[model samples]
Target: MADDAARYLLGIDVGNTVIKAVLFDLEGRQVGSHAIDGQSTRPEPGHVERDLEELWRNASEAFRRCVADAGIEPGQIVAAGCAGHGNGLYLLDGDDRPLVGIQSLDTRAAALAEELAAEHGAALHAATLQEPWPSQTPVLLSWMRRHRPEVLEQAGTLVMCKDYITFKLTGRKVSDISDMSGAGLLRMPECGYDDELLALYGLQGLGHLLPDLIDPTDVAGTVTAEAAAATGLAEGMPVVGGLFDVIASALGSGVVEAGATSIIAGTWSVNQYVSSEPVIDRDLLMVSAFGPDRFMIMDNSATSASHLEWYVREFVERGGHHDDPFGFCHRRLAEVEPRLDDPYFHPFLYGSRLGAEHRAGFNGVAGWHGEGHLIRAVFEGVVFEHRRHVERLRAAGAVIDHATLSGGGARSEVWAQMLADCLGVPISVADGEETGALGAALSAGVGVGVFAGYEEAVSGMTRIRREFEPDPDMWAHYDHRYSTSRDLAEALQGFWSSQYRDARRENNGEEEAK
Candidate 1:
């Protein structure tokens, strides 16, 4: 009976902060998980990178540990899928060795993207249906050609994070439509690359760099002997083309149909929903979902649970292990109730959705404040951002009937209630924190015939673990605070831009002196 229950699906997520592997049964129960701490190095102030070999080594080790920890044999992993951070360039050599691995959080190409936006801005948006963010493949490749032409000259292919890992596993280079179609590279609504469109972004002659694109649930390939020996996966175990981390999380949360919404408050605050008709507008960003005629509309920012993580790691946590940092932080936040006079934190320690020019810090503070007050403010600020995203979705005519919350922020009861209150809607959360991996695992299931399709797989596997209903009394208080936070951002944007100009001038002076 134990062996009967042991037939499992393995899902791997190569996220920004962690490389995690999770094992789940067909019933959608997580059996075991193992994670390796992932860190991206900042070579320059804006550049975020990882050593490719080091990333592979850590990811493979975590895969091995996950299987071992689950006490399952390698043969039990019938099928597997990968969910990874989207839109970063992972350059591969002709020999299949990694040349460069850039993270989605990278901003090294920001200036180049800005420079070309004038001539190609409309072209980019029309082709990809996405604003060319700094880490889009073309923008990053453009920066490389200018600063390091040799890197582009020797290149064979460009792939995202999960696609690279799939290559390492199966000796095949392929990507799902979900990653490719939205990166300002593929001509969207029509699903191929165009040389004329490539020329618009200075990528005219390098169209061959695009990988073979496939459906997210198609069999990408089977694991190789070399990969099996390293990670304890079966040599012939099938691997499926996977999805963007956000989409995987959406599927894992059972947001498979229209009117179902998902909010992932991980390193980014992602609020999105699947739509039969794509919503193209300024306030929202979109990507192809898993299938044809489907799109995922998202309003996201770097301002989310990472701020909570920063507060705990930098301030509350001691040098060694602390058992419950989140619990401790929640208790501290509980001390300070949500009041009219509380300080407002921008929570933009990372880049902001409000335009990159706006900086993040405490706008209002006083002598009466304490760490608890700051914690409360951070929680409120992150939820306020969630409210902003849902508002954008609503503005685009989304109903948002079922809003599911996932990620680090959902772990906090206090924060979940705050989000519910701020959004004025009842939100549901599922049992597993590894929803991204679980979503991948479900894709694996469909690939190997364990389920019929997403509709069947999601219904069979997912169940709502908890639900938070809005508190009527707190809505007015939060409404006032959220508006104040927005006002503060408007007031501070020009000052932050001026500060940036001053710093850039000082750096230019230093360089010219040399």
Candidate 2:
């Protein structure tokens, strides 16, 4: 037998809703995978946070289950990688112990986002190439400074979710470049934290919170004996710096070339294209894509499956015989489409590109419609939001001839076909659902010299399953609906603003009475 490649890789991805540990062979095929379903604690509306220790416990437990289920020994894993959701803030005390972890799905910093924009939006865009959002690390830190200065006074460092886990595993407090880039803290041209950008964001006073950045492919550290015992992994195994889930999904889906784009619809609508040069033309997020020359040009937000998940969980009672809730909702949704006068839903429950005043709602609902119509509206609404980003990318001269679809929203044939038709592009579904984990493993392969470099690793590991061609007839129909959706958003701009203003006034009155 020719030298049989027997080594395996372990990829750990800590997302907003789940902690996934997947094992992949050198060929990039998944040998086995396991997931732990956990949720962030919502103390109040829009304030999404997690208990730091609980998050780590879920990740470590998932590792044990993954190893046991995969029937792979800890020593068999040659190298490992850790992938996490980008942005948000995970702080460590002076003792390097985790404080509280705020996930990227949070909107607690909305007021701060407005404050930053009104004061320093242009400067921030010039530096980071994206506008401020509520979940970014800097905005979160600013909110803490204003509301709870005591925590900031006692804090030692701030890191992303995976950075904290990496620190726990290797006793090093380092973060991957992609995570830092998206945190609205780094200067794109310099690829490091900038004093000017910090000053503009009014965050220079707290620049000590930023963690050191390392390349995604760099070996962050060796798995220490303490971490190894906790997670059933071999001690001293190499742990590489992995990309953010957005970059990881692109890497995992094989969108490594400039023209190749990827749509990730997990908790967020990440519409990104791989580019050789970092362009700062308009308001788009750019992050390092594992290489110095390469960056992921992303128009993204918590505006994809998160919207659908929220709608079904709150309004629909879908359960019992179905495999999952979305499945049931989609099954009913597939029955209603291509018809005009359908309700238009704004996927702004989390936040909106239409400005801070925008909120989520369904328009054109009537007495004749049932639960099925609302379900279908939710699907189209989220897809419409994704199309909005795709349009922005297209306008920027980004070639999105064809794109790979990966995540929970892509699995639905109805929604997938709708996405293809609506975007007017051939959408291909990638082979693996755990693209983020696979991305991590491939980077580990690069770190350990299993592959010569990132390019070789990506080629050896990525595969496409099926492609859905856009239907000209369906595209014509969706074109009208898309225009209507845009018009609806524009029309409601005044109403959304007035609603927000009135609500704030009511709350102020209540506070005065107290």
Q: What is the lDDT of residue 315 in candidate 2?
A: 62
lDDT of 1 by residue, 1-514 (tens): 5754768999999887688899998899888789998778986656788877877888789889898888888899899999998877889977778888888777667657777776787777777776666777788888787777888888898988999889989999999888777566777777677998888788878888888989899999999999988888889999999988889988998888876899998888999888886677755665565687778888787789989888888877868466888888777887876679898988877557665555668757889998888888888888988898889889978887558998878778888888888888898987888889999999899888889998899998888889999999999999999999998888988898886677556645753574
lDDT of 2 at 138: 86
Listed in order, each prediction's TM-score against the native is 0.95, 0.95
Task: List ranges where model 2 is wrong by over 4 Å.
Answer: 1-4, 286-289, 317-323, 502-514
- Can you write out model 2's per-residue Cα lDDT over 87-205, one digit (the tens) per residue? 88888988888776888877767777888888888888888877777788888888787666788788999888888778877878888878888777778756788788888766667
Task: Report the C-alpha displacement of residue 164, candidate 2, in angstroms.
Answer: 1.4
lDDT of every predicted structure (CA atoms): 0.83, 0.82
Residue pairs in candidate 1 whose N, alpha carbon or C atoms collide under 3 angstroms: none
lDDT of predicted model 2 = 0.82
Predicted structure 2, TM vs. truth: 0.95
lDDT of 1 at 328: 80
Q: Best lDDT goes to which candidate?
A: 1
